[model samples]
Target: MLVKDMMHPAVCVTPRDTLATAVRKLAHEHIGCLPVCDGMRPVGMLTDRDIAIRATAQGRDSNEVTVREVMSVGALCCSTTDPVEKAAQLMHLSHLRRLIVLDRRAHVIGVISASDINGFLSEPRPFEVVFYKEVLDHLGHTHRSQLMRISMAHGTREEAVRAAILEFEETRRVNHWNALADGYDVVSVRSNS
Candidate 1:
């Protein structure tokens, strides 16, 4: 699979945007990070964790501080045509959840996350199933030691809970016509994943 095949459209913010504004965008979009751009050029990245550690923990006011004050100095990017495996490896090395996707001209186009890759690798399932799996993967990695200590006690219970949770997610998808309306486009499940 190619990067473009898995990347979702990028939602961006400006350097001058207040942390409050950026946080709102993050929450509204249901994304963990955003590319901070100066006009059409990508400059850096802002993540929820960045805000928490650099601003909130420091007691800086979100409404007063700008994204420029807290965003990572530079954005990591991958070409749209690059292989998905390459992107995944880069993310693993960098300990990042997502990377900015750029066109040949270096224009930011989209963002790709581990969730996207995991969804691509697995057989198609309800969105909620894939989402929960990704969440478990992230938690397991993030708290590897803690989980290992408790794994024996919770292993069977965890599996049962996961199965029950996934079973509750609606598996049926609504079908629609192949043709698009004049000004509308549909992102198929393959690409949406």
Candidate 2:
């Protein structure tokens, strides 16, 4: 099956769009990601996690943060004519569930998710099932590992909990988004593995 045969019409965001607006759209749509578009072409991706990790965690005012500031740029895309399996392979490699589908003009026509692929099937193939599982597993592991470790000083017990949460947010920003990695505040920690 071709990507165009299964992809959903994309709901995209502009680079000038604010994080606050993006969050509202995400919640209202019950969707995980938004394509950051320049006109009809996708330029980046803003996942729900990106708002939490890259915006909320950064101590930046959500109203002031634009999608371009934290979006995962240079999104993976596929021609509308490409086979669905090819899109799945790209998703597996990128740990993504959705892919932007583009036309000959490099304009986004739609997006295809693993769910869309599944809907295309009455009985999914073994590899398709496995690929879907692997994508979920990878995403799960990534989120769990965020804010894994951080230290912050606090006076009261409640304050300590809040501080720790903020510290985790800061850590996730530095480690995942590299927001402040160049600053002197960064301290590298060795991984146990």
Candidate 3:
């Protein structure tokens, strides 16, 4: 699969946007990060951790700081058409869980992360099984059932399922592995949708 197949549609912030604004956006949108953009061009990425480390930890008022102050400038990104494995490798090497997916003109297109890879790996049939059983065994029945219902209702299987897992992780749904496991329940139901 390629980055385009896995990344989400562009969701970005502006350089002038305050760290406080970015935090609000992240919380309101239920996202962990956002690409800093200037007229469709991605210049950087601001993550929750960035705010925590650079602003909160230092006792700096987020409202007084701009995203440009704490954002990861010139973030490592990949093209939409790039192989998924390559993107995963880059993420691993860069110690970044998320990667900004770019378009032909280098505009932000989507974002991919380790969870996306795990979601892809969980698909039944032709793909290799990376963490399927482990996921199911951990999440159990109730939570898995809820995830399945959401996935089936939306008809989002691989990439979308991964995105959901990532969201669950941010919401502190037990653990990432448990979230991944619950994601399998959604994947199985989504296939029938």
Candidate 4:
């Protein structure tokens, strides 16, 4: 699918807008982010988290701080005609929950996030579904989270460790395992529908 096929037009703010304005939009829209734009062109992004960390935690006056002061600069954007896979890749690489979509004229058109991809995840094959879902989990959602842990009382040898790993993977798909160390080598097994 193309970005134009799935993206929704964004709610936005301007650089000159106060942080108070952005916070109000976030609450009113019940959304996490807003594209900071100048006319039709996007310049930065403001998120709910930014307000919490930059203004609230720092004890700054929201009405005095502009979006330009806390908004993240240089958003990642994909063309309207670009494939959905391209958007997924960019979001994954950038650790972003959503990406801005732009037209050929570099005008902000819409937004694409993992939630939008959920509707189009109608792949016929099981593996294809799993593939997209795994990417989406890293991109935004966390429907299933898998973790693995291994503990040894004796010597740590290569062949034995490999066998132990393989055994643990096949049987312990969710939640229980004796771990080697505290919070060491955790793995998120891909979820299936």
**Best candidate according to lDDT:** 3
In the range 20-74, model 1's lDDT, one tens digit per residue, is 9999999999999999988767899998889999999999999999999999978
RMSD of 4: 15.6
Looking at model 2, the pairs that clash are none
Error at 85, model 4, angstroms? 1.2
Query: Which TM-score value belongs to model 1?
Result: 0.61
Residues 56-163 of candidate 2: C-alpha lDDT, one tens digit per residue: 887999889999998998989888886565676568878988888899999987888888876554342222100001123644552121313332222444444444
**TM, every model:** 0.61, 0.60, 0.62, 0.61
Model 4 residue 57 CA deviation in Å: 1.2
Give me the runs in candidate 2 sitting further than 4 Å from their true place. Answer: 119-193
Q: Per-residue error at 47 for model 4, in Å?
A: 1.0
Q: Which segments of candidate 3 are over 4 A away from where they belong?
A: 122-193
Residue-level lDDT for 19 in candidate 3: 87
Total clashing pairs for each candidate: 0, 0, 1, 1
